[model samples]
Target: MARVPQARRQFAAKDRQQARLCAEQRPRAPPKTALGVWGKAAPTPAARRVQDARAHAANCNRSTVVLKRRGFPMMAPGQVDLLKKRGKKLGEGHFSTAVVTRWHGADAVLKAPRQKPNVGQFVKECGLLHTLEGAGGAPEPLGLCLYPLAQVISFAGPQTLAGYLEESRSSAELLRLAADLCGKVSEVHEKGIIHNDLKFDNVIVDGRGQIHLIDFGNANPQGQTFCLVSKGQRCPWLGPEVFSQHLSSPAQDAFSVGFMLDTISKLMP
Candidate 1:
């Protein structure tokens, strides 16, 4: 081994001293799994029942057991108008009002169906958003509110990759963002879930440059009406068999990501 310089030797000695101090001063975290990942705390008895209720509560007319069991923080009705609407009316196309809203001093996009809201779709969307909580790119669904006529999901962020691509940017940054999006979508599909309405507008981006997939009104569980709509840019994101009403798979999500990358590239100046 080469002899250490005096300055270098002093730095290593200080590092060791700091490590020892930290080990003594810091509180220990809960034990991690064999793979060094933190293990999730087991749900309480009440929480378990809530999970079951959410799973079975297909429609908005959920049973009392569901309402009571699901301990979701209830936002008072009529609080919807309190949110400050921001940004340009980002080109709404769905059967809902897709306006961006600001809540709790943060940027969160809101989606509330205009026609009679689809309850099954609401449940699936909540499930997917909640499931992929911290995987990245995907926006966090702050809360899902059920109404008599319509339901709303609050997501954190603004405009999707499509909106970003509309302006000039570096190709490398675009590709990296696209790749990160693909990885998150793969995580979604791996959970045996499918986001039926996958498109640019549905993918929201925040100020920190993160991608969040939104719009769950068209989402469906494994054995539901797998209605496929191939409109506008949706066609490129969807697979060929998607036109035939075939159910979505993980590969379909990858294809959608690939198309999104292509679309982003074309818009770059």
Candidate 2:
């Protein structure tokens, strides 16, 4: 073959070498996992924190805000006064009525439902409240009075979460509040009890951001029992798994916690 220019031969060799190297290289791609994207095999503390923050934000957005006020008769002027009522009717729904009250030199919330007295419910709620009270962040169960004709427990409180959100509290504060509430509730549920009527109004937050869960008309012992509330009286939140023509279980209470938290996030100011 005719002699080729040295520069041209060198150029050909260089091109061949470049092609071989390119063939040996791995394909470029976007990361397929969190760790991959973050350049670690596992989540770093900072990454975990970001994820937790986002999850918390999502939880707040999904927190339960629908205050069920049904069936709860209006507070008699005397009962309202007796309760040291403070805030205007925070809300009302089909099963219960909520009033902001001041008791024990602190802001409080009192909830009374129109339904007949449920002693099992009462015990469960009181027990849980008492237990949570021990945690300090939970609302203290000051006392419960059974309304003679109304068959309602005039529950005096720790406080209402709604009022706190209404005041436009911060997410950090809210999350901390939620964590405390979750801890208390987890303890309650662990005891094999179900707060069947778990809802937004039932969770009260006070000026100090303490959480108090209320409304126990539907709470039951850990074991199964016949559904007592009239079919029409059922709170929509009582999931089918728990309230399908019957009373709820611990899972139902857990569902309520999830549902309640979901409601809070949406209502968080």
Candidate 3:
């Protein structure tokens, strides 16, 4: 890991400290599940099987859960076949490809890691989702399997935040959206995960204007620093130190939210 410059590193630390405070200050909403709120579930064995499997939570996690690949229960090939036959195709990203399909007759999306190594990420995502499970405003994590290395999530709308902005002309609505976005990010930060990459393309906008954050491959735990792997050029949502200091934290996430607010400003007027 390349060491970030000390000046930028220090600033990131400060940013994270403030972000933590903001997260602590906000009132976190409880997850809404049929069983009850998160951490308070009395799910049947069958119900538990249908949702969380090992390291993957149907929604979010408080700590990183890493599991060995072998002997791990995986989704049957038949399950994968069903998704392909029943679901529609969604967009693909660098790490994985998604297929929207029917699960128990409900519309669903199956996310499979494109590479073997990325399987760990999908597993991590499950834990994150589990951590956030039953939480209001987050998408439902239907099921996850390891044999075929796949996860089944409820099929959210296909529209991107970028596309949603095209139809919005009201500054009031835009500001509300920005606040909602910040609120969601704050909730995630409180759980100690930094999305690392936050931008228009990474956010999903439902027809009702709800925003869902997607993609966690670049996500990192709060306060911990890693060698900047994407290396060199930084995305527009990234703060200045991302490239210069080579670190990721709640501060970077905070900066991304600011950058998004700036985007909203330019786009509105």
Candidate 4:
């Protein structure tokens, strides 16, 4: 009985250590997890089978970007202002609306939180993205900002991972996407940010096969602990630790990446 708790702690510690190493570009083998936390009832990803662009678009869970003017515009620091609202709603979750808007003279997405609590959540995510971006060679996509209007992030190309899977693709292509996603989660963990939410819908791939990870509203900084009494936010990507009401940690992020990789791997024939 004592060894069980001790072993779990050891695994978690190693996960956190791996996260730090990966964030810093120290090459290491990825974590190979046992079925310690995943259960049979956990959500499994479905195979996407569409083969053409038209078919992919039709099959993807997408919303046309709605272009409408807000009565009041949103403004970010650095003189960024909404010049135009672009398209229909790109995506919407329980906490935010992901929409395209012209900001600082470029097209950007407004990941606007829907409520007060969500605002704080978005703010924290923005901070993490900025920090990791700086550490990761100042990547442009990480330049997310909390505008009085919304949390503005760079707009990824059309097609979520699910949609990308639908397009006719090679086995090599599938492996690249999975590997890239694994790298992304590790990169964030290196910075001590736990992405509480990781799913196919949040990952976008362009027509050219470029990958983008978006939406960090549920992320938390290192060492901050939150009680698991809430029910509405749990998703299928989460691990058993989360289901058991433990605090979110870097290990959970690893578990998510593990499942994400497994899910994407099966997309190949």
- Candidate that would win on TM-score: 3
Q: Candidates sorted by TM-score, descending order?
A: 3, 1, 4, 2
Deviation from truth (RMSD, Å), model 3 = 28.6
Model 1: lDDT of residue 210: 73
For model 2, give the 10-residue run with minimal summed lDDT: 63-72
For model 4, how does the per-residue alpha-carbon lDDT over 101-174 read when each residue is reduced to its tens digit?
Answer: 66567766666656653444554565566667733111233233333435566665657877777777788888
Per-residue C-alpha lDDT of model 1 across residues 1-269, encoded as one tens digit per residue? 35568778999999999999999999997665343236566666798999888876654446323643654433444655454235334346557666566667765656566667675555556556666564445555565566532233455555676777776778777777777687767666665667765778778777777777666556555444465665656465666655556655655566767777777777555
Highest lDDT: give the candidate number.
3
- Model 2 C-alpha lDDT per residue in residues 1-269, reported as the tens digit of each score: 35568778999999999998998895878677666554766787897999999986664334212111212222344665577435546566555556666555665556556466443344345555554443423345554443321222333353456545666667787678778778767666676556666666677665565665656546665666645445565566566555455544667767767776786687566
lDDT of 3 by residue, 137-188 (tens): 4456676666566788766678888888877478888888898888888887
lDDT of each: 0.62, 0.57, 0.71, 0.60
At residue 156, candidate 2 shows an lDDT of: 37
Worst lDDT run of 10 residues, candidate 3, spans 62-71
For model 2, the superposed segments whose C-alpha errors exceed 4 Å read 1-159, 226-236, 245-248, 266-269
TM-score of 1: 0.61
